[model samples]
Target: MSFKVAIIGRPNVGKSTLFNRLAGRKLALVDDTPGVTRDRRSHAAKLYDLHFEVIDTAGFEDAAPSTLQGRMRAQTEIAIQEADLIFFMVDAKAGLLPDDTTFAGIVRKSGKPVVLIANKAEARGAQGGMLEAWELGLGEPVPFSAEHGVGLPDLRDAVVEALGADRVFGEEDEDDGEIAASDVLIGEDIADPDAEEVPAYDENKPMRIAVVGRPNAGKSTMINALIGEERLLTGPEAGITRDSISVDWQWRGRPMKLFDTAGMRRKSRVQEKLERMSVQDGLHAVRFAEIVIIVLDATIPFEKQDLQIADLIIREGRAPVIAFNKWDLIDHPQAVLAELREKTERLLPQVRGIQAVPVSAETGRGLDKLMEAVVRTHRVWNSRVSTGKLNRWLETILAHHPPPAVAGRRLKIKYLTQAKTRPPGFVVSCSRPDAVPQSYVRYLTNSLREAFDMPGVPIRMALRTSDNPFAGRAKKRT
Candidate 1:
């Protein structure tokens, strides 16, 4: 059985740095700013021969139960309850502070095994702080440095002794093996016209969905409601989440992974470096996710930033589902829903027929409809159309509205063929690709969307010059 360990400490105690060291990857964002980590992030960790799960939690602080810091402390308490061991870390160079002493007593109340780690021991004057760490009454402090990999073996030994050597070094866990075929998605230039169609929803592989929007838009609240647990920190304060947290969840017995990303604002308005990093991380999640749920506040829906986020999702070729959040505050549900639908079609014509579900994350309303829309959108995103059917539709479209004349030579539009799926893309061969007007291309795109019943997903069409080697070469005098 795998052991669970929780890293608890005051703000800026290098808990996240140690977490990255144990995880052997930079999964958590580290910065000089205190309280950078606000959520409890867990990952499979390995220390030498010992392998187990480690959780990184927000720093412990003394605040009211209703304050943001208090909510953060509550999350840390949850982590403590779930962990088999606790790593109460402290700064050896800076020594212990009042907050450290106060929280140490609290952690002592828990019956779980505790390992006191004194980080930053490499510094010249750290010996004095290490001496001070002994007063916390947890145990002997293990002098270590998370930045330079100091005292790792001693730390590992303490853990082994605490959890027992047999359980600490158990049988090796099995590997997850190769990625499922359904996970092979997203690349440019689909050369094979006859490649097998994308498989239907593979329930075994977890679907990745990212929830993103502006600050104070209830992104975390929505995710917490879906998981039916306060898995993340939520408060009245804006920008409570700093890291891109991913949670593995299930709905209707289908495995799913939800990513809660930091809120994004306009470039001009985002002045702080940390907020910029958070926004960039959110964008990365949007690009990697299969479907992006753009949450818009119902009180002020369709703001410029909201439209920009939706457009960005489309440009990334990821399926998008808009959630009209804060619906509980809306006075007229039916009228608001109709108005929002109209605004969606008018504002985001690129992905026509997009589903905008009015949802109240505060209450448990419209959640079922929201998920149904998500599953349906995923189906459309991965769909493919046969080449023959595409060519037939292309011929009919061309016969109705022929390409306009450029330099007195009408463009000869050849047959159409699908290049790829996962946000379906197509290739249209024509006589002069450069001469095709942007308006004409938009027409073909709309026509394809309507003909194939593709809606709410970005559709790409590349105009390539018809492949004719002989025609390009000098015509022989015959």
Candidate 2:
């Protein structure tokens, strides 16, 4: 089992920054504003050679029950209770406040190993604050700068000692040996698509899928129904989910990692600091996911925001499966389904023939079909076509609809070859590539989609003028 560490402190203590530092990327949103984080976010973190699950929690606050801050505080308590070790952080620049001392006592009461961290230690003025941190009774505070990376080694050593060297680094695991700093994997390492070829779907690697929609769109309920348990908190309230929570499960024996994100509202509507952070976090999930399921409420399908979200997914190059939730609540299912399909075709012409599955996330209806669509779209998104087959297909299409003349000369189309596929990027070599009209490019894109059976996934095509080796030399000589 991997070690679990929770970073707990008051608002603006740089806990999120430290969490990002340990994770080796900016997974958490960092801002100068206090109380920016509301819910607990966890990721598989690597600190040097140590691999552990690190959780970034909301700032600790003393608030009355039934308040929003109270709920946030409860979430932080859950993280603290579940963690094996706690990094009780405090702002060295701000010094020890009464809230820090109060929370430190709470952390001590949990009986988990505690490592006091004095962040912002890079400032010369913070020395007095670091000295004052000893009174918390946790232990000698590890003076460190989460922003400047001044004392990461000391912090890592402190964590190792707190969790024990053997526990942090398994003794008998031969393959999981200590890795060099250069060998550390960042968050983008798993996200960066393979360059030239579409990666085969591996059963071992869990397919990351994010389910997102507007508020009260039944996103969490849908996830609960799929997992066959109420693993997420759901109610009649809008904007319930504040964090992008990931749940790991097996779908038809295939490993899957599902992310349930906060409801996304219009930019103008997102005025609060906390909600803005939540939306940003949700967007991050979409970028990281391989397939994005845009959940829509069947009664009010294809709203302006729904279309906008779909557009965002296509622009991000993630395979999208449009799902209509609350189908059970809709009247005249046949007509509604027909209209939804027509609207999808008209509004989202960019991803023609996109998969639109109607399901009742509440009653668990049409779930199998949704999963099937997800798998199929994911396969197509990673599809690649050989150069010979692509060129052959291009020849047939070109014969049917020849390129239009531009500036008194017909564009000479030579060859077409697929350069890569995550979204199936292609390169077309021809004469006067710049003269090719966008309408012709669109026709080729549509034809390629139809010919290859690649629907709902983005396809990239680039026009390149064929090179003449001796043209530059001849020009120079002349």
Candidate 3:
């Protein structure tokens, strides 16, 4: 197990900047806005030879116990308790505020090894403030500049000395490869340029999955149930999660990275700057995930927003598995299940025969089936077809219902081949590609889905005009 370090401070003190700097990537969203980070986010961080898990938490704030800010403070306290060491950060440029002194005392009470970081130390004006930070009495303040990458060596040495070099290094000898901030793996990344074809899915690599849905859709609850732990913050509130928190876990012996994203609302309804950032972070999670599980409220499954979220997932070319959450609450399970199935197929015909797994996040009912569906849908999404087989299938398809004539010329499809997978995409060479109607393309798409056993995953098709050798020949001159 690696050492855990939590960075806690008042809002806008450059804690996130320090987190990104230590992680060697911008994993957390950084802006001038205060309170952008509401939930705690943890990432594998490396500072030269020291390797440990670093948690970036929301700023410490004083608020009523029933308020959101108070709940955020509660979450921070949990991190402090779990962490082996805490980096008490302060804004050197802004000087020490009353809140900083209050939080500093709180950290001192925790009795955890504390490293005082005076951020914005690059500014000459911050020099006086850094000197003032020593009065807090935690320890000597390390004047560090998170943005300018200054004084990081001193900070690292301080951490190493505090945690002890033996404890920091542990038994690990080399640096674990860097994990990207985005954590998104696109088709291009999986495809090998030197190889003749796309490689098979590496089971050794953990599958990146994100749970997304509208506000209060039980997304976080579902993930917590799946992981068998209360790793995420959940409540009656609609938008408790403000950051895309990724947790690594094993599902039936298979490695998986599950991301619990903030509840997404319609674009027009999003107003506050913090909420807007939260939504963007959720979108980033979708892009980064190989499979997106859109959790829906069983009582009201097929709302417009649910369909919109599904459409967004399909548009991103990620395999989607619809999990109907809160199934235990539905009094008429059979009727609602039937209606949900029909609505899913009718409304989202783009991904015909999409998997709709009914699972109760509260009771953990049907979770096994949901994971099975996820694995199956992901396989289909990454499936590849041989060129010979595709052309043979295309021949049968064209023979049954040939392309209609356009401009007194019959459209002829010469060949077809699978271009990529992970949302299978295909390209077809035809005589009159431009004239091929979209309805006809839809026919081909539906036929392909039916023939190839590709259900619940998006399929892309591109029409390209085949080369014509005789047209360019000088037959008229003769």
Instruction: List lDDT for all candidates, in order.
Output: 0.89, 0.85, 0.87
Task: List RMSD in Å for every model shown.
Answer: 2.4, 5.3, 3.1
Looking at model 2, residue 158 earns an lDDT score of: 96
Ranking by lDDT: 1, 3, 2
Q: Candidate 2 at residue 181, lDDT? A: 18
* lDDT (Cα, 0-100) at 309 in candidate 3: 91
Cα distance off (Å), candidate 3, residue 115:
1.0
Consecutive 10-residue window with the lowest summed lDDT within model 3: 187-196
What's the TM-score of each model vs. the native? Answer: 0.94, 0.79, 0.90
Worst 10 residues of 1 by lDDT: 174-183
Off by over 4 Å in 1: 171-185, 188-192, 195-204, 471-478
The lDDT, on a scale of 0 to 1, for candidate 2 is 0.85
Candidate 1 vs candidate 3: the lDDT winner is 1
Candidate 3 local distance difference test against the native: 0.87
Off by over 4 Å in 2: 46-50, 62-70, 90-109, 118-145, 148-161, 172-205, 215-249, 259-263, 268-284, 360-364, 406-409, 469-478
Q: After superposition, how far is residue 2 of candidate 3 from its true place, in Å?
A: 5.3
lDDT of 1: 0.89
Q: Candidate 2: TM-score?
A: 0.79
lDDT of 3 by residue, 1-478 (tens): 3699999999999989989998877778888998878778887787877878899999999998678788789889999999999999999999999999999999999999999999999887999999999989988999999998899899999998788888887875344533543445455322422233545765566688999999999988888899997777787888888788988899878889899998988889999887898889888889978899999888877788888999999989999999999999989899988988998889999999889999999999999999999998988888877777788899899999999998898998998888777778888899878899999999999999999899999998889986666876776765
